[model samples]
Target: MTPRFAITDAEIATVVAEFYAVARTHPGLGPVFAAHVTDWPAHEAKITRFWKNAIQFDRSYDGNPLQVHRDATDVRAGMFDVWLGLFDSVLRRQLPPETAAAWSTLAHRIGRGLRFGLTPQNGGPPDLRGPAR
Candidate 1:
């Protein structure tokens, strides 16, 4: 079932667009995302789909976020904090208070999972667990 956040696809898109627009220029996040995402618009659209599928369960996105994050060797554990901070700011700016809070909660949850998956366990490299395939 979908979430009860009362967020719309357009608001999600706005949050994604605004977040990336600022994040792409951020000193910490800019280089990493720039290295991987060549097409900004397409990347934003894909991310929009990802969020839609995440919050609304629309099934419009079909990629493994964990696998994708694992593939980005430059993605450090601390980056999640920065990303989430930027995302929260965008969400608050673009959405209503209740919607922003609910979406932020979900984003933080997903960010925690991603950070755990990317972090090294027992001093070894992070496990890939095969792949999204």
Candidate 2:
């Protein structure tokens, strides 16, 4: 089933552009991200594909985001928080309330999963499960 509130590619691009603009304004992340994304056209295309897969569930993206993030060692912890905050702000400004909520939830889950590896036992099993009942 299609979502009632769907965001288009143009919308995603707008959000991403705004996000990069915000990053550029911030001293902590601006220099690092700008240096890494020296090739603006290529970086934009990659990010566009990434977000397309994220919001639209496109199957073409087979990249490992965890590995990518790990490779970007220059991305400090605080930068992640700032990035999320900027994303949330953009979603709130651009998307419908329901869409924004859903996207925020998804972003949070992805962030958590990336920061802390997901467990195969489903969150390490419930404490009250009593040793696999």
Q: How many steric overlaps are in each model, in order?
A: 0, 0
Model 1 lDDT tens row, 78-128: 799999999999888888888889888888878877888777773433443
Q: List runs of model 1 lying over 4 Å from the truth.
A: 122-133
State in Å the error of residue 92, model 1. Answer: 1.1
RMSD of 1: 5.2
Question: What TM-scores do the predictions have?
Answer: 0.88, 0.75
The CA-based lDDT of model 2 is what? 0.68
Expressed as tens digits, the lDDT of each residue in 16-112 for candidate 2 is 7777777777787788887677877666667777777776766556677666666777755445667788779988997788878877876765666
Supply the TM-score for candidate 2: 0.75
Superposing all C-alpha atoms, what RMSD in Å does each candidate have to the true structure?
Answer: 5.2, 6.5
